[model samples]
Target: MPKNKYSLIRYRVINRCLRERRYVTLQELREACEKALDISPLSDRTIEGDISAMRHDSGLGYFAPIKRDRINRVYYYEDPDYSIDTIPLNQDEIESLVFAAKLLEQFKEIEIFKTFTDSVQKLVDVLNIYRISGMDTVRNFIEFETVESNKGTERLPELINALKSRTVLKLRYKSFTSKKISSHIIHPYHLKEYRNRWFLIGYNEEFKAIRTYGLERIISIDTEESKKFIDIGFDTKKYYENVIGISVIDEEPQNIQIAFSEMQAQYVISQPLHHSQKRLNNIKDKIVFEYFLIPNYEFYAQVLSWGAEVEVLSPKSMRDSIKQYFDSILFKYNH
Candidate 1:
């Protein structure tokens, strides 16, 4: 006859009953399963199969050491605390587990995953003790991009902790354009990743405005436990909706139209510059793209990167800006 459909569950139920009580008769075990585990009453043959399977089955391999009373026909574990949950794995199974642990360890460098470092290290220690075969070769087979830690990356742990605790932070910062250091107390809202760098979005207490500070510019950060956290209810999506990269300009979003030469248009079509990009009517040798966004520093830089292949078609102010930028660049090269 086939084993019970829920053979594993029956094993666990039988294991518990044998462990808890000094001795339990077959009928008593069935009653406990029905009441405590919400399981259907099992037959004598099914319970007997479960006990046999738990002892020898490679998947479980539980050394239950069950003893039976000859006079009363009751069963119990010789070692009361013994359970299938603590079963030891074979060498092959241990190596397989070690491989899985190594995979998780690879991602520990990422800022968001910093909290799991201790747990991941514990797992790695087990792997080292076992000295799993081909463990050294595992790192070589798979390669992960290791980004160098920038200036402010060392402060990630403290910043993340402050954000989690909802504490206000005091940051000593120095911008690239400025030599002097400035201090501001900010309520951190979000951590944004862009172009291989990290930025913190927060409510600046001194300026009374929402601002983004690049992690590279931060000189030092300390949390203020005494200050009550102030949440201005900033809408992240709407705030950055029309802006590109990390910059948020004060101007209203406008329709931005640009014409790209036919040669360069294909690349733009494949990978759109902005999420709000829409293709417009193409001229004889140029493909036009219309984007709805606020003109920010990053957006301006992106337009400049394309150089002569692209031209601003609408928004005269932006067109003038781009023209003047090119004129200056040309004058510098000529000199």
Candidate 2:
């Protein structure tokens, strides 16, 4: 027999023997392989070469515990302590793990959710130690619902790619109310999703100002000669600090506050308008939930959603706008 083939035969024998036996005295390995695998194994030199090959090969080197034990002159597995066995995982548990991995990916965008995701991982691993997910649960599983449709299908993939590449995009956009098409040269800095709609924040080259554009309203996106956006950085938290809506704070700002009736307080508390929201004492007739913010179209839109349920308590500009909006909305239905 060829020397190489004889050494290959010796390699497989010692590999398995080492995991259980701790050490093989060259002769013992060849004898054991002959007994267990029913192969006419080779002599001592061949077994020695096999052990050397096992230590070197990346995959098979997992059996190096034998050499380490031999260095300390120790050999024993039969205080009956153990043996190497396949980790038992049925199909359902595998699927549950894949589901968990997908869930972690879903929350990858939200910076505030880091600690919560980490805690859930630790809790799941601990549960897995004792109870198998496939065997026990009867597959009473959680599923995330998709949006009705990909209204922004093509733009969605492009937006993600641009964010990854940090490239600039020229967008053909139409406003929700006004379908007039216009072009915007934007360097997309961040993507924000709120209430199932996607928003892009970027520095608009044409306007020479930072702007927020909705992905759904974007008619088309063209990759321009890519230029890096270095000067302008979007701090999502700071951007939303003083505003309840999508509109950025204007140069001249006011402390805009709103008061809600008892019926509306439940809804206001349920969805906080801003991070800086503070609750003041409730008036006899109304619940005053105070937020000092810039009054923008986005803010006005939110206020209008309340209809007669809320009242603007401060900043006369906001109050007047609310009155005008109410008049406009009422005219549509009342007239």
Candidate 3:
């Protein structure tokens, strides 16, 4: 690697000029670096030093096959296909790859990732081709948060195929509140994951409205080949833009303000609850945050998770709802 970031940038700029430009001169290389770096008056000697380092520097590991045409007085790579980017990965880079491959290994059994199983194994074998000791020991040092058995993952491949083919699906689903399993024909639109759980968002043909269903609650899924697929032109980004979690309510987005205790504020600031979260002026000793979102069960659950450390500050309806929850808890304790 280059000692500083600027040297690396200059190397890349020169590399591009050599690869793309015909008969690249020393002046042209200097101009390219100056333009890329947004600095003027880059000396010819500086560009020459950069080229020499790229060609000979063992530390950089480039050893680029750069050659100068004596007759035309131009620089070019001896190997037409040569690029610094194609350089072999260093030990650290190899280790990171090993880490990623190990993580993907955990999901190999899932139908959606079945195709990637052989590819991932081949990558692992390639990484170990040089007999790099301890290449397979990456999992010993790092542990990932993984579900031993994630329910409904088996349906992923079918759901993905349906989405691609724009096929309607008949689903038998059981809600947590009811023991009865209801059947519905849905035009699958989007799949979303929140807190490690998967949700299917689609247009329910029976209800004649867009709905969200927990994939875990889906007892069975069947392709409705006879029925016509509904194309609602669902914009995924716009649909979830004002929502915190999977439950996108019918109500308009509200400016919900919350105050957190100093202890909890640090955690909240480090990891924001929502993309629209913004820090406001502190209220007394508490740190305040504002969000433009349509509050749903997930949002409430998030706020309630903080327990005594959090307080809703605005929108009396939301405050009242949160208060009712706390009051019910207090009532249970009092009883």
Q: Which candidate is the best by lDDT?
A: 3
Task: State each model's C-alpha RMSD to the native.
Answer: 9.2, 16.0, 6.0
lDDT of 1 at 233: 91
Estimate the TM-score of every prediction: 0.62, 0.56, 0.74
Candidate numbers, best lDDT first, in rank order: 3, 1, 2
The digit string of per-residue lDDT tens for model 1 on 1-335 reads: 33455676677788887777769998887776666557676577767767777766666667578777879899888787787767766666666676676676665676666688788778767656666565563434665555555666656677788879888999999988888999999999888878768899999988889989999899888878889999999888988888889989678999999999998899989998889999998888999999999999999998999988999998999999998998998999999
Worst window of 10 by summed lDDT in candidate 2: 78-87
Residue-level lDDT for 173 in candidate 3: 98
Candidate with better lDDT, 2 vs 3: 3
Which residue ranges in model 3 land beyond 4 Å of their true spot? 1-87, 114-138
Worst 10 residues of 1 by lDDT: 131-140
List, residue by residue over 1-335, the lDDT tens digit for candidate 2: 12365455555555556665665466677687667557775566656665555545553422343333567543333323333232344455555665675466455344434447767667456545655444553123555654444355446667888878888888999988785899988888888776667788888888787898887788888888646654476677887777755668565556667788888887778978866577887778888877767777777777888877888888786788778877897899987
lDDT of 2: 0.66
The clash count for each model shown is 0, 0, 0
TM-score of 2: 0.56
